[model samples]
Target chain A: MKAVPAASTVEVDGEYRLKREGTSLQWNIADESALEAALRLKDGDGIVTVLTMGPAKLEAALKELLARGADRAVLITDRRMAGADTRATAAALKAAAEKTGPFDLILCGRRAIDGETGQVPGELAAALDILCVSNVERLEKTETGMRLFRRTENGVQELEAAGPLVVSMCEYAYHLRLPGILSMRRAKSKTVEILTADDLELKTGECGLKGSLTKVITMEAKYPGLRKGPKETDLSKATEQIQAMLREVRP
Target chain B: MKEILVLCPHGVDGGLLSKAYALSEGNLRVLVLEGEEQTAEGYGAKYIHTIKTTPPDEAAFAGWLAEKIQSWGSTIVLAPATIAMRNIMPMLAWKLNAGLTADCTALDMAGEDLLQTRPAFGNSLMASIRSLSTIQMATVRPGTFRPVEQKANEPEIIPESGPAETGKVRELSFTEFAGGKPLSQADVIIAGGMGVGSKEGFEKLAKLASHLGAGLAASRSAVDAGYAPFRCQVGVTGVTVCPRLYIAVGISGAVQHLAGMSGSEKVIAINSDPKAPIFGYADYGYVGDWETIIDRLLHLEEETL
Candidate 1:
């Protein structure tokens, strides 16, 4: 999850730079919602550990999660793991999770704003050999097991599953809560366990671009289309502009 | 001729069928799940292997397809990008020790090699992927390619009838929301974003949408804020629409949100932030508060009506 100053964000170029040099990371809104979903389900039980795979710079991001009620944080950062596609990325994360587990449920954002693949959770679930439920809007504790309300293209689907499952939360469920002074204090003193590929027993060939199935060969700017005149701020003029256009296009 | 296996769960997947036809040099065996053989053939499926089962579970369905592909000697595997299939394709690929590229928007052949290109990084980049394994697998992006009718070409239909092997996952209860026009087919849509302010703000959007005979949608921000429902959220995580007219209200147009609905013929964006990225993509932009602009638009629409 990589969030940055909205105004400074630029399009990814051949250099594959996500953000400008001076830009810093913040909370990815969707993943924040996911953390909230996980915290609600954990509910005063179980250690809700936040796991992420990125550079050492993302250590601050993991610490930010701690302030949001994540009990512990683990960051897997290795030069060998750079440019790993979804499958290989999951392979490394799977190694990290195994170290953090025997867990009940593994939760993630429905889709990362950057990748937008919405594939890692399923691939990771397959790696962990567990049931993967995605787009979960709401989850409540039931006597037998947990009940999940999954948001789909049509509507919502209700599902019941036992523990040791992987789930991705729908952004519509709940936004992440703000960190109070006490939580912020806790986060300051906490240390994020930074692990390398060697620690995870991941080989260089199996963790990065060398192991990934996909490769980004080209990145071109999208073609610009019909541009109406400069933005009109005057209410009366804007309304007239819209009305005139509507009239011209009226069937 | 090469034997290619295409997983067609829906009525017919035009993209996969067309790609399979070209790849196989006219040899295609469509492994369908509760599909019509006649319809599959119309998409140029020379052979349709229907997997008959009760609401086929993905795990079981993938297992069955893997077996069929192995025995049938089809080296190329194609699946349409669906939620279930997205999960299944990776598992199948892993099981077979193969390479898979999901949501491929383009496919081509280079000598004996198959090339697949899919969008990556919020539609900012295109990934050209190929598999080194014996079996090449790809999940085709839905609705990217047009369906060509091959009425005269009849398929050899092999219906594998009976209940499929049970898997760990079971069918769950599905509930459709209070009906609204499906975004996929909506001709006109009025969508709001984080800047829309609140749930009440969305009510304003809905009113304008109703007046214009358009569907109502929202960005992930509005949906997360409880201003709109998840089903109404238009983005990577929700619906991909190409509505004729897409009116974006208070949207900053994050690349994540724009990727879904950028295909609109006409886009009108209303936002107070004059420097907003959305202005770059919209055909028309009104730099003002959405409430103010929407109010005027609503009044104008009412007067016209």
Candidate 2:
């Protein structure tokens, strides 16, 4: 394997703190699908980096990435970035990515579990002016470029594109690899670089509360019906009921 | 008292409109936009604002909606989380600079804010989000909210005139899938996945669907396997459904598949593998060969009925 300096970050409290100081291979929470695909490609000795912006409590997510196979981690911690909408969060990530430098691939999950808008990848791609492929299922490193299998409304589509690309990986792309004992041991000693507003040369208006284009006006909890424990039935009876119900509905 | 404005799309299903009305509480004024005559009549909202359409475009629609939002001084806006609605609502939200929660499975009036609950992280977790802005917006998933019964005999309708604009994405042509029924609207669904084995196996599932007077649906894997059409696939990439009864046969319930039909009133799964993920969420599960079980059920149906 070519030695590409990798960099990844963790968002602690809300700052993009970099791990591995100056290394190239970085892994962060790529919660967008298209971004993940772009990052999985095997490019020449060029470093791969990942970064995330979230609360200090999310260190576990960052650590998990390291255990899986990331080179380093950076944690971005600050209170100002809390409860940020997509635009604000994307801005923070964009700022961090710009500072990380000369990256060839950026990967993210197609949509974060918390916010399923599926907009950040496209929005970030727009910000970076890079090509983005969303909902990618499989990614392979090609000799000339990267080949990707993306899921669509119709079926899986295969595409070959050249780097500096940003692709998002679908949830089903691969079972997140578990960190082996050796990798976990190494990650335990690995130092993470923490970044804040000062480290990243971001405009005050573009960083946190001020940069967000939208705001949440109101919030109310929804009460989906009460959860009942699993209902148990014998196979024969269950099968009979299913048959009867189908017959009644059909007849 | 704070005034909240709920924006119901012009031609949404009457069933969906009823649910939207039920969700409304004190001081929440529901405004149904008049898009098509059929939709307007079915919705029967107290306030119906009509916009003339001559070749619709995003700019014209945005202009029309912006004028109304300003005039009404609406606080909150609600729309169905469908592809069509999602395409337009984001632009509208951007124009208004309002925070919008998309694909909200649950909505409730929590003090001053609307507590929106939606699935996050591959449907493994649920997050409750609140907007901290003047105009809170949300797009609710269809079939999650229960439509209320119509109380009034005739609902008041208001019509307004405005200039129509051209649409950004022009519909050059439209083609409807030739199938049993659209899975999203189906009351009963018979869906299959990779476990169905072959094309001949899929035919059996189709027969079961037809016999049940239900729509035939498939998982993404089934579609990938070429056993079903893309439109009939049910998942994140396909259609989300809240059918009355969903029967999954020869399919292991992946989170993607569950995301589409988890809201069904009843779910039954037939798989030989007892540990299949589908059994976890199923109301009833049979740990046996699908072919044997389905053949038995079909025979039972014939003998009994």
Candidate 3:
């Protein structure tokens, strides 16, 4: 039983890159343990395509994916798609995914550090009209479908979902791989196809501000320079003050 | 003249009404839309419209509210920055062609413009944004305003009648957790976090809270670690508490947690980490082991009583 390349990288050019040294391809950005687990389930025949949406600034993130073992990379970028909110961003990404054709599975970080709304992957799942398994920690390839272990409030729960599903990686999902010098150099020379709005034929309104449903009406300073005087910290006096404050509430 | 409509979710809790009334002085006339049960009189408001809707059909309720706003001839609208208000605000704002700012901690009358303040970028940065459109909107966080108190019973409560639309989502079932004494309502709150070490540690904290009659709260990490239920969590994803005396026990004080409870009247942090962010916001911070400190506090409470 050959181990699969359980790690694939999505590049800025919207291509999936997998390491040639590995057989099975893993599709998560975080959690190397989960990636190794994913490799164990593969027969070493799957192709890993790195997919990403953004300008060339995301090239580094994509190259890192390649170093981790993605077979190829795909970059989806367009000037018209700047300043997109989550809904429009999901729409554009879904369009790019449709253009690149199909896949047995799609994976994404549960949420981006920027705009911690955690709405993109859910919105993307809705846009693509697929089954979404959020916060998946492990994946096991099965004969008919895939088995996944997801984090829940109480504990980890297992679920079986058919292929062609989207899984959002949680905080503890998988550890991100470190890109070796050799893999980093090789990723630089790798071919990454950059797809624009024209390539996806996305409507102008559906790509950026026009397609976004939410808008920021106003922004204001929350905390200015601290105005409160320094606190008195005599332990006995502070305890008395706290007790006095508590009494005022009940009374 | 450009007008902004504000939906007072709690219908001017006297505390909030006075603040809105103060902010609406001069050319700004705050048209407060509230529930029919809420009294609108004595707030010095130019106009008051009360909405009629029950819980469980808020989407339809929002559509109805949007329709009323559409006919009200207002360019911008605002809502109280409460959890219930936020649930329907975005959809209503979207329908009204207006933008919305959630959890605005501060708002000001900037000449002809309205400046809103909110914590952004993981609460590390504060952003002050001014909307270009005439019909800009935002939801102000509660307690952000200092409500002016005055004795005047009769302001006005106008009852509104309209055809409610069908809603997209249906309420299947709901469970209401007994929230104990809400931190906002409590004068003293004893909050625990993951740094407490174990469930036994949390029990000790609870014993201290019991002795002091303070409400028990937990940080997100504590809740995530199963030390406490989600309802007891205090952070951005949980409840915003403004207790008079907040006793933070063994909490590392992540920014998200700080954003929710920083407005407390006074914060006393008990954590071993001298460099913990909680210390920065604490009125008094004890840099020592929580176990020993909690045990001592409990003993002192018993002996003093």
Candidate 4:
């Protein structure tokens, strides 16, 4: 799923603050990497469907994913779904998956750029009752099962997983192929199926901001006074420290 | 009398136990696997349960653990917010229908309710969360709390039965990624971001990294823009580095990106945007054109040659 934060809401001075009201109507690059990875795994077979749950205006983002080679697209939009937290959002997306698939595999971007929670994959994996691989760089097929090269804190570890698993791709793990004119034309012609709370049977009271586990209490801008680090303006001194620090670490 | 249980199969960080102790008022138990019994004992946990289980069947563990939590009537479950814990805890949370906060930076007891503070929207916003379900669960971040010192008195060690559903999934073989030095171990790092412009732009930073014998890193935008490899990316979604010196070029700092590298001993940043968040974190700030600043650095190197 692609999410854009309202850039205009950002207020930067000596401090960092943002109002997440405006949203960009485009694909999140991390999710786009996952989409591209899904295509690579497709390997001239299997269908790739892109789904996003948001307001009615998010259809365009789904269409863009379609142009990039998704076989089908789903726009699961409902007012009741608004302001859903990570758990609720994962539940809604998982429920949408149920409606669209008895799918053998599910792929997601590492984390949403907006939320930066990195929670949905595990939550969704739990929701679907499947093995969730959080950090995969590459994927391969085996005779009995599939193999994935997963990134760990130290290095990448290869793991064997079967279908009916959810995997989230690391950022820039795979480069997305540009949509050709033919695929773009087909995407333009296709009618994106829309699913509502009625279609998914989502309980209104069970979702939205009210259903969320957390709440933002207040906001403030960061300030110069807040920072205690001594700022150096001398390039020569900075360069010397860099060299000394390098020697210290390498030695 | 242990109502709070902390699962530390992957050993334990001081922050995890310190938070656990603070919330439970020094009355919490730690759980580890059989071989890790001594390691958990060193952490000064009053009661440590070392389960004799070894299968990596997370499903079985989740089920067994969830059942155990219900039976014990444990109100709070804490795990290291590392990727390893993340893999299994959410599954457990799902099974228990519990509310869980990921990467919780703060955990406090407010009249029996756990007050959890976590970063949201790429650290652009902070959200205080509480679990509404039967059990409140949270994954605490590392380096936030100090490690409990090992005491002379030994902790009580309880041997636990392995999950019955184990051995369902077996490990066949293994191959670790054969690659260059990872960002986490690098002494000096040169990180890039969207301000680097394109592939051509990133190469300049890479050249400097090579010259300085430093590892290369990128903010989320650079990786998303295809200017750098995913392995070299550094941010909330990428690897964290504790490099002695971190030089961020054309990188606007985002909280997500800062989460990964804010621990660097010293930082120097060059970005065109005067108000770029990178400057706030940097020890040395250069608010100017990245291209021009980079060219000058390269020219100085050439002159020294």
Candidate 5:
């Protein structure tokens, strides 16, 4: 699970990247749902490990996941991994998966709230050379594999995958449970495992800005209103105005 | 010469094809997997390529396209950002060691580079990006571009065949979303948010929507609150809509919600909060009780008819 900038706390600098220095972070909403699904599916002996790639500041957020019933937490953080685009981020994540996983399934939020690219899960699947399913609204563990219901624009597609798979979970499919006082206390002692570029055996050239394939040319703040000033009115007048607008559109 | 490769994996939306064709500068090679060649030609495709075998899933299709892209030697690729292509394009880009911009709102050529523009930071910021790799790729939403006028043209048809990755994920069933007209296509949308209060409140909104021949849409909070269905959701996490008129009731106009409906031609906001962000986006604002407003609107519609 990734800790992204809270929507309300997002601040973009004059430079290309977001200004993360003092911005607050929260578990991505879709990722929380992904984590909830994992927690629910885990059997008695099954372990729910949460992995995230970000700066060291993300450790606190990972511990929060540990408090909320995750068995383990791993943070893949390296100075060299800074400014990694989706592809390079996938490369680093692929290495971490190899280091810590031989698991049956991988779950990711459909997209990061900040980038809103919705591309990492597919790129990660490619990097790991595995099958990927996205926009999955529901999942059930089967004897051989897993059955998933994916929400598309027009319909719901029910699919079954037999091998290792990457699933990009739909937002709020499952609400994440909050940690109890006892669990929160116990979670403080559990250390979050850290992995660096050297630990993943990733080359310097294949990490961070150097490894990224895309560059942000510019960023412009999108102002909210097209209308310079709205024609504010009472209920009666608003109703008339709406009627006029409706006629203009419908007629 | 390097050509603009538009991947119409499924049926082509003419708008997407025409827009790509215009950007292609008469050098567009359309790769249609399960789509029609005639549709591509109708939208001004000159060099049409059709896949012989349909790949089972996005993973298999991406594998096939990656190999074909190398052989075709096209540097720039565009596809409609449907669910399947959203999955396929990234994997294809990864395989080609390329950069891919997702859900691009705008596309242009910066010299030889494909300048891709999209909403970033949950629609608060618009980012313009470019790929540095050998191949440049981007996926555009289906209706963001308008279809060019259809014209009669003779097009070269090329048949291509490849091995597909098979027997991985099996499709069991598909259920088409049923009910009123889809939110994206609706000319007028009556969207409710958290203040709708309950499922019953949404039903009231639905009644008003049906009365007006409009579609019912909901904010993410409304969907989360179970006041509305996921299909009716409009936001960053939901469907982006560009209706001719959008009537927002009780929506606070979170940036996420605003992103989806920012394309609306005109907006009318009905919220109790006088200072709601939604009022800033609205062409007309009414700070009052939504229930009273909805009831009045329903009565007004009946009388107007």
Candidate 6:
């Protein structure tokens, strides 16, 4: 799970990337839903490890995840891993998962609120040589593997898949549980395991901006809903005009 | 000239196919997985390769597509932003060591480079991206472009061998949601926001929508507040709709809300706040209580009926 800049607090720099410095951060809502799914799927002796890739400041966010029932927290951060696109980011994540994993399931939000590319999970799955499912809204533990209900634009796809696969979840699929006082206290004593690029064995060109294949050419502030329309504060006139426009629409 | 490849997994999205045709400038090759060759030919694709899938598998499909794309000597690839493509494209990009932009709203070519434009930062910024790899890829929004009205071409249809690798995930069943006309295809939409107050308020809007023979939509705030379901939410996270007429009832237009419905041809906003940002986008603005405005509109509709 990653702590993204709050939607309201998102500000773009001249280069078109989000200015993450001093920005208010919150759990990417979709990732929180994934966390919720992980928590619910935890059976006896099952551990939910919350992992994220970002700067050193993200340790606080990981600690908060630890408070929210995560048995362990992993923070993959390094100075060389800045400006990584989805592919490069996935490469770094794939390395971290290889170093610390060999687990049953890996869950992520369908897309992050910031970039919203939603390509990381698939790329990471490719890097790890695993199956990946996207747009999964609901899932349940079956005798063999799991049963997943994936919501798509046309219909709902039902799939029976085994573990050792990556799944990306919808934002509102599961509501995250809040941290209890006792859990918060316990979380304070736990140290967040930090993994740098060197620890992951990511080569010099395969870590950060240099590793990314996509480049943002330009970014412009989108002035949304810029239609020139006449306004009327008069209730009677407004109703009359709306009635007229309604008549024009083909049934 | 390098080949521009388009993938039609479920079928050829006419709008997406036409957009690819425009970008490729008549030189287009399409790979249809379980889609009809005639539909692709109608969009003026010169070469169409039809392939069958025993089961949908992203990893296996990506590996196969990567090899095919390389063999065809294609430099750019485009697919509709459907669930399957969204799942498969990233893996394909990884296998090919390519870069991909997701849900691109616009596409252009700048001196052999594919310029992909999409919303960034919750639709507050528009970013134009380019891939540094040999092959550039993008999954476009389904209905972002208009379908081509051109006649069919005598395209060469080849049957390609399917992927041999079987996936672990097994398909069970698919349940298609039954409803009236979907909001995306609706000619007119009556959308409500938080100012609509509750589920009961959305019911009122639904009544008006039924009366006017229109679709019902909701702002993200309304959906988040539990007044409406995510399917009805209109915003960046939800579906992007372009309708002939859109009515914003009790909606205080946030940029996120506007991102979804801004493509609407005509807008009518009804909010108690005269300064609601929705009014700025509306062709007609009414300042009053939603119940009062809805009641009047319904009364007017009833009288006409």
Which candidate comes out best when scored by DockQ? Answer: 6
Candidate 2 lDDT, tens digit per residue, A1-251? 00112212211121212222334332223342333343344345444454767556546656765665566666666776665676666667777788876676677775553346755654565456555666666778766556766654334556666646666766545544567787688778776666776677666666566666554443332222222324333567667778766655453
Candidate 4 stretches with Cα past 4 Å from truth are A6-15, A43-45, A213-251, B52-55, B150-154, B164-229, B240-279, B284-305
Better of 4 and 6 by lDDT: 6
Native contacts retained, all candidates in order: 0.36, 0.10, 0.10, 0.36, 0.71, 0.78
Who is ahead in lDDT, 2 or 4? 4
| TM-score result, candidate 5 | 0.90
Cα distance off (Å), candidate 1, residue A26: 3.3
Mark the 10 consecutive residues where model 3 chain A has the least summed lDDT. Answer: A10-19
* Residue clash pairs of candidate 4: A6-A22, A15-A222
Task: For candidate 6, give the lDDT of residue A209.
Answer: 90
Candidate number of the best TM-score: 6
Pick by lDDT: which candidate is best?
Answer: 6
Write the residue-wise lDDT of candidate 4 on B115-196 in tens digits. 7887654444567777776778888765556567555236777787858843334455455433345575566788999999
Candidate 1: regions farther than 4 A off: A1-8, A11-20, A43-45, A180-189, A223-251, B1-3, B22-25, B53-57, B161-167, B185-215, B219-227, B235-239, B244-257, B265-305
- Candidate 3 DockQ score? 0.11
TM-score of each: 0.80, 0.63, 0.63, 0.80, 0.90, 0.91
Residue pairs whose backbone atoms clash in candidate 5: none
Clashes of each: 0, 80, 48, 2, 0, 0
Tens digit per residue, CA lDDT, model 6, B1-305: 45589988667778878877887787889988646888888888889998886355677888888998898888899998877898999999999999999989899988899999998766667899999999999999766787885577788888898787574788899887544566876778999999999999888888888877788899998998999879788876776777889999999998678878887879988899988888878887778887877888888778878
lDDT of 2 by residue, B82-104 (tens): 54355345556655656677777
**Residue lDDT tens for model 3, A99-145:** 77677777766544324344455456556655565555667776767
**TM-score-superior candidate, 1 or 6:** 6
- The candidate, 1 or 3, that scores higher on TM-score is 1
Candidate 4 docks at the CAPRI level of: acceptable
lDDT for B24 in candidate 3 is 59
Worst 10 residues of 2 chain A by lDDT: A1-10
